[model samples]
Target chain A: MKKGIILVLVIVGLLVTTSFASVEKPVMGISLISYYNPFFLALRDGAKEALDEIGGTLLESDSQQDVAKQLAAIESFISRGVDVILLNAVDSEGVIPAVELANEAGIPVVTVDNDASGGDVEALVASDNVLAGKLCGEYLVEKLKNEDGVPAGNVVVLDALPVTGVLNRLQGFYSVIQEYPQIRIVSTQNAQGNRTDGFEVMENILLANSNIDAVFAINDPSALGALEAIDAAGRQDEMFIVSVDGAKEAMEAIKNGTSFEMTAAQLPTLIGKIGVETAMKVLNGEEVDRFIPVDVFSVTPENVDEFLEMATF
Target chain B: MNPFVSFLYKNKVTVAFVIIFIFFAIFIPNFLSLNNLMSVGKQIAVNGIIATGMTFVIITGGIDLSVGSLLAVAGVFCAMLVKSGVNSIVVILLTIGLGILIGLTNGLVITKLKIAPFITTLAMLSILRAFALGMSGGRSVSGLGDTFRFIGRGEIFSIPFPLFIMIVVFIIFGFILAQTKFGTHVYAIGENEDTSNILGLKVDKNKIIVYCISGGLAALASIIQTARLNSGQPLTGEGAELDAIAAVVIGGTDLNGGYGRIIGTVFGVAIMGMLTNGLILLNISFYYQLAVKGLVILFAVGVSRKK
Candidate 1:
């Protein structure tokens, strides 16, 4: 036992000496909603690029869409005394306490791609989600109008209601689609904001609404999932899909002229870049806007080549 | 034989934890700080609680995959109740009762129907997940009041509240496992169920109680999780059972059962928590983090195995 105790003490001493050897740099900690989605991966790549330019350390954690895990990540960041924190909240309201903790630590928090409900955030660098939704809605309406010369069709909405950004997209879609009297929303259901759930939900929706002329999925994964379900049911030619997030898969689908027609692409890479740049600005004692909006554009078959590389996850 | 080698072999789990802790402290920046250590403690509390109950089940040669799904169910139930203006204490009690009832059902179906624990719990996992999703309409139930949040977020004397709860659970369950007739019966059954039954050790009753304890503890974890997030998310505990099982197995619990200790599980939980916290602190990429964790778990288990 004495020998074991002496060995452990020696090891502990060695570790303590090594830990003090790390050099000081502007450390930026980022907590993403999850790494399962390719969008977040691209965002991380962008952030990493920006951080590397300044020779700063970037610490990242995947919260797996659990608010508790996100909170823990934020706490870890605070404990490490990071210069800035980039938060992609799993839940808008649930992340308030974590943000507040960062606030107490005097760490500037910049929300990336998603907004938090409360806390003193330095900025929210995100894409215009509402516009993305509006663009998809408008594209769907235009396609339907071109087909019939009057927007008259049954539309199905594959919704993911938990995310505020997705909800904003839905609101934008509603604002446009509600203007067309002939366009009727036949079915609306939650896809839980994932491909598997989207496919399962879309399969059920397809069975119930056989007359669906178009689908507006909340994001690319859901849109792709719906496309798969449509193909499985041999109804790919019967309806087209429009979604937000210009993911690589969705871009390929649009280019291949599959049922996926258009996607309102959010620049996650740009959002991530701007998030870090804004953090740098805040660290330099410069005033920045509370909301930093990144541009979003529609990706269609005609323009897929122009933006295909940018959508690579 | 060297005395040091013998000591290390006898307390492999604890030694493994110490070695791992020292490694992270050396390599990961700010990993040895008091605040970070506390943060890891708080983070591990939820899994630790579940693993404590899981220890009982695994020792009896059973597994509970449904604990994860059951956590979701209890979380949703607690959130819905809180949303409907139910008292915090009442909601906790009701949710716990729901967990016990589900656990009871799991026990009955396994024992009476003579279904293997794996198959029964696996089915329960799917059914309970569906129930949670159905009840919450596939959306997270949020806006849980502050009073309820205190259960998870509140701290006592600068220590996280969840850590205290986990300690209490470990203590009670540890005593029950180490110093009770039920505990011995649990081992007997795991070693040989027919022998235990023939010896009139009330095998079925003990098995039912073990499952009930597992389910009850899972519900307890759900409350802490719900309170921590300040919401009830249907997807809350996805893949959590695997984490518990990994902890139990890493702590020297045999898969075939009848051989483990609660103290070993404590070290197991600590080791797992340290790995997660340390990896992020070291700035390891998420993809590599998964691989490293698997390797470490395998290494720890292998080291702890008796020759």
Candidate 2:
């Protein structure tokens, strides 16, 4: 038994070592909230590209939206002695301890997309969420005005309350929509930031509010979900949908000229690229801004084709 | 040679764990480091706790899919209580109580209504998840205080607090499973429920208790998770039932019931935890990691099956 165990161990050791020989490089650890979403996947791709340009090794973990797993990944990053860390927080407040651990290790932490609530973060690289919301609000207003000759309609919001980013988008949308007294928000319900919830919530909203003229979803998945509900109810032409996140599906829907009129496209790739760049700067002892905001654009039928041509994720 | 091969087959789960550990220790940088191991322990604690409860239910020839949803609801409930300035002790007790209550309901429904455990728990899963979402407004309940965080984050003697909790739970459950009359009854029921019923074993009562243990332990896991995240999230623990089930199965626990050990489950959880930690250290892509995990699980379970 002992000899057999010894033989197996030797073979495994040899195979593993040869296959996973470590190379000396400036290692960067990235803990994504979850890679299931295309947006976060694109963000990871952007970071990978940036790291490759500098010949740095990038170690990435998908936290699967569980704060415990995310913390474990961050702790693993710290143990590996990575030069820097890029964090996409699953929960802004829940991630404080992880950021603090990075701080203690003297490793710079650059938060991408989602910001942490505590700890001495070197920088935060994220899209201007407020601007994304504002862009959506503007597009909604313009589209409503063009369709009805007045920026007046009963709108329902498929919102996600857990995400600070989504909340900021809502705030920006509310800031714009609240101004037009003629445009009333008939109902606002939480979609929990996914397509299934978005569809279910919108279905209930539709049952209650029959005269809904427009819907604003917090993200692409939810927007498409709301679109599904609208189409199911045979109210596609009666209402138009707008959302944030220039996801490929959202772009396709826009190009097809479905009820999904427009989406405020946040450049997750840019946020990721800037995140790596900022982490490098912090590593080099160079001064860096605490908050770096990427731009958001409006993806409408007029420009959806152009955006789709350049989309990588 | 035949005897040796039979022994290998019998102990395949341990062999798999040992091989994986050796591989990571040799190739993955810092895989054997104290900090890395501690983190892995912490990572597996939540699943480990739930798997402990799952073992009982599985040993009784049953499954509990609602553990995940029960965990989420318990977490959100605890978080709300903490936010409302409830004492940490009271919050923990109430959260665990809620878990037990849910488990009791699951047990009663399956027994009294003559429904299968699978169907009963599956329906409970949807109901509990919706309840959690409604209670938390589909948002994460954040800002749980430092005292509550200690349950997940605080350490005793340099080990993670959650890891400590997992170890204590394993010991208690392991002892119960191996040394108690209830444990013997569980195995008898799993082996042949009808025969055990004829033997006057209080079959229905035991089954209900087994499910209660599963639900209560699931709630216990939620406390650690909620404390670690420092928030109560309605969406947390989504698909966690699968992870716990995976661990229990990987530990060589017979899914059909009557044949498993807590020690095997422990090794199972360890193997999974090491795989996740080691893969990240090796810089493997997330997409490939999922594939590797699935294959390893299948290989471990497949090799251990009776010839």
TM-score of each: 0.88, 0.87
DockQ of each: 0.41, 0.45
Candidate 2: clashing pairs of residues = none
Q: What's the TM-score of candidate 2 when only chain A is evaluated?
A: 0.87
lDDT of 1 at A22: 30
List residue ranges in candidate 1 displaced over 4 A: A1-25, A137-163, A173-217, A222-241
For model 1, residues A1-313, the per-residue Cα lDDT tens digits are 9999899889767644543423234688999998988789888888988888877778899999877778888988888778889999887777887898899889999999888888899899999888888999899989889555888899999897656688789989999989999999899898877799889999999888868899999988888988999999999989999999888888999999999999998888888888889998888889999988888999999899999977756
Cα deviation of B211 in candidate 2 (Å)? 1.5
lDDT of 1 by residue, B156-222 (tens): 8788898888889999999999999888988888889889988999988899999999999999999
lDDT of 2 by residue, A1-313 (tens): 9999899879867655543423324689999988777789889999999888877889999989877678889988988778889999988877888898889988889999888988998889998888888998888887777455778888888887646787789889989978788888889898977899999999999889879889998998889999999999999999999999888888999999899999888888888899988888887789998889899889889988899986755
Q: Evaluated with lDDT, which candidate comes out highest?
A: 2
Candidate 2 structure quality by residue, lDDT tens digits, B189-305: 999999999999999999999999998999999999898878888878888899888999999999999898999999889988888888988889999988999998898788777
